[model samples]
Target: MGMRVKQLSQLRNRIVVITGATSGIGAVTAAKLAEAGAVPIITGRSASKLAAMRGRVSGRCGFYELDVTDNADVQRVVDRIATDFGRIDVLVNNAGFGLFERFEDAPLEHFAKMMDTNYMGTVRCAKAVLPYMKSQGNGHIVNIASMAGKLSTAKASGYAATKHAVLGLTNALRAELAPDGIAVSAVNPGPIDTPFLETADPGGGYAASVKGYLLKPAQVADTIVRVIAKRTPEVDLPLSAGIGIRLYGLAPRFADKTLGKLLNRK
Candidate 1:
C-alpha cells in the first residue's frame, strides 16, 4: 500500500504539455493528468475554450492559444513552456483532425490540411521540444495516432495517410532520440466517441458503421496516463483491435478481404 502511494506520488507535479486541448481526447487527457497531480499545460485554438478547460481541471494549469499547424507558433509556445516550467516532462501530440472521403472523390486541399495538421504539426511540436528534453536528458513524447494508421478503411484514405505518417514519425523518433534518453511512444486508438466524427464523417456514414463499438475518451486518456507514467513503448486501445491489426499484417490479402466484409456491413 505504501509502495502504491509512492508510485502515485512520483507522478505528481510533472509538467505535461498537451496539444488540441480544447476538446475530445486532448481535453480529457489534460484533466486526467491534472487529477493525477501533474501540472498540465494545455494548448488549443480557442481562447474561451482554453479558459474553460483550465477551470475544469484541478491543480496548476496553463492554457495557451495555439494552432499546431503553425510551425512558428508551435515553436514559440513550446519554448515558452520550457522556459516557464524549467523543463517539459512530457509532450502529448494530440492535435489533429480527420477527413473521411473516398480518395478519388476527396479534395486535394483536404489531404493537404490533414497532412499539415496531423503529420507536420506533430513534427513541429517534437522539433521544438526535443532540444529542451535532450538538454534535460529525460522526457517522454506521446503521439496520438490511430488504428487507421496501421490499417486503412475505404473512406479514410486521407485520414489514414496522415496517421500513418504519425506512426512513422513516432517510430523513427523513438530510435533517433533513444541515445539522448528521450522516449517516444505512439497511442493508436480505434474509433472513439468524440466530436471527431462530426468532421470526419459529416454524413454519419462511418459513425453509423462503427456504432456500439466506439471507445470512450476517458478510456484513451487512462491509457495515455499510463503511457506517460510507465513510459510504455506503444499502446493500441481495445486490445482486440490491436490483435486484429497484427493478424492482418501477417496475412494482408486474406485479412483485408475478411475484415473489409465485416466493416462494410450495414
Candidate 2:
C-alpha cells in the first residue's frame, strides 16, 4: 500500500492531456487522474459539454474545444497546452467513434470518417506532441484502441480496420520513440457499457450480444492510469477476453468457428 501510494503521488501536478473527455472513458479517466493529483487537460468538440465535465472534476482542470480530425486545430491546442504547462507529461488519445455494420452494407463515407478521426487523428495528436516530449526527454502516449483491433467480428469491419491501424501505429511509434525516452502504450478494452454502444450500434444488435461482458468506463480509466504510471506496452481489459483473443490468433480457423457459434455470427 505504501509503494502504491508513492507511485500514484508521482502523478501529482503532471500535465496529463486527454482527448474526447466530454463523456464515456475519457471523462471518467480525467476524473480519475484528477483524484491522483494530476492536472487533467481535457479536449472535446462540445463547448458546453466540456465545461460540464470540467465542473465535475475535483481538482483544477483545463478544457479545450477540439475536433481531432482537424490537423491544424490539433496542433494549435497541443501547442497551447505545451506552452501553458511547460511540458506535457502524458497524452491519452481517446477521441474516436465506431460504426458497426456489415462490410457490404457499410457506407464508404463512414469508412473515410473512421480512418480520418480514429487513425489519422491519433497520428496528428502524437505528431504534435512529439517535439515537446522530445525536448523534455520523457513522456507517455497512450492510444485507446479496442479488442476489435486484435480480432474482428462480423459487423465491426470498419471499426476493426481503424483499430488495427491504431495498433500498428502504436507499435511502430513505441519502437521509434524508445530512443527518445518516450513510452508508447495501447489500451485495448473490450465492449464497455457507455454511450459508445448507442452511437456505434444504434440498432442495439451488437450491444445486446455483448451486454453481459461489457466493462465499465471507470474500470477502463483505472487501467489507463495504471498503464501510464507503469509504462506498460499493451494491456487488454478483462484478462479472459485477452486470453481468448490470443488463442484465436494462435488458431484462427478453429477459433473463428467457435467464436462464430458463440457470438451467433453468420
Candidate 3:
C-alpha cells in the first residue's frame, strides 16, 4: 500500500455513520472501513442504492435512506443509530451533488439546493451526532469537500460555494469540538473517477478536460479510511491537488486565468 496505515486499535467496532454511501467515495470507503473492522452504517437518498451497498459491504452493515436536507428525517435516523448502535465514533458527512449553471444566469433555486445538500446537509449530520459524540467524549467528523472549495470554477460556481461552506464548517467545528475530544476534518480532493463526474458534467465535458488528472474513487476512499483510522484532523487525498488548492487561494486571478487556459474556456 502506498498510504500509511496508522496503528489505531479504536477502528474496529467504532460505529461509523456515513452519508452518501450509495456509491462513489462513500460506498468504497464504507466497504474499506468494514474490511478494516468497523461497523459502518451506510446512508443515501436512493433506497435501491442504499440496499445494494449494504448487500455488498464486507460485513453485516446497517442501512438508512437519509435525506439530509430534511431535519426530521436526519434526527430520526440519528436517534435510531444511537439507540441501536449505542455510540458513534465517526460521522462522514459525504452526501453532495450539483448542477453546472452560470452563476448569474441561473435561478436562485439552484444555489438554494446546493446549500441545502452541501452546506445544511453537513450541518445537519454534525448537529445530529454532536450530542452523542460530546457525551462519549470522543468522535471524528469527516467532511467530504473538493479542491473547488479552496479553488474556483466558472461552470461549477454553485458547487464550489457549497464545498467552501463545508470547509468553513469543518474548520470552525474543529476548534469548537476540540475540548470535547471530537475531531473535525475536511477532505479536499481533485477530480475523481466516479459517477460524480457524470453528475457534475452530464455532458461528459468534465471528464474530457480532466483526463489524465482524474483519480480513482477507491484511491480517494482509501485516504478517507486512513484519515478516520488514524483520527487525522485534516486530509488532502492527493498532495498535488492540495498544493493546487493552496496556490489557487494565494492567487485567485492567476489560478482562474490558468484554469481557463487549461480547460480552453472562452
Number of the top TM-score candidate: 2
Residue-level lDDT tens digits of model 1 in 1-266: 77645655667999999999889999999998888899989999999998788678988988888989888899899988887888898999999999778789989999999999999999999999988988899999999999899988777888899999999999999999999999999999999889988998788877787888899999999899888888898999889999988998899889877777775432
TM-score of 2: 0.97
Identify the runs in model 3 with alpha carbons over 4 angstroms from their true place. Answer: 1-9, 252-259, 263-266
Predicted candidate 3 versus true structure: per-residue lDDT over 1-266, tens digit per residue: 42443443457788999998999899999898898888989999998887677567887578988999999999999999899888888999999987777778878998999899999999999999999999998999999988778766677788889998899888999999999999988888888888887777788876887788888988988888878877788877579767766787788788777766763321
Give all candidates' CA lDDT scores: 0.89, 0.91, 0.85
Q: Could you tell me how far off, in angstroms, the CA of residue 255 lies in candidate 2 after the best superposition?
A: 1.1
Instruction: Sort every candidate by lDDT, greatest first.
Output: 2, 1, 3
* Candidate 2 residue lDDT tens string, 1-266: 88878878888998999999999999999999999999999999999998788677997778899999998899999999988878898999999999888899989999999999999999999999999999999999999999889888878889899999999999999999999999999999989998988888888877787778889998999999889878899999888989988898899899877777664332
TM-score of each: 0.96, 0.97, 0.93
TM-score between candidate 1 and the true structure: 0.96
Which stretches in model 2 have alpha-carbon errors above 4 Å?
264-266
Q: Pick the winner on lDDT between candidates 2 and 3.
A: 2
Residue pair clashes in candidate 2: none
lDDT of 3: 0.85
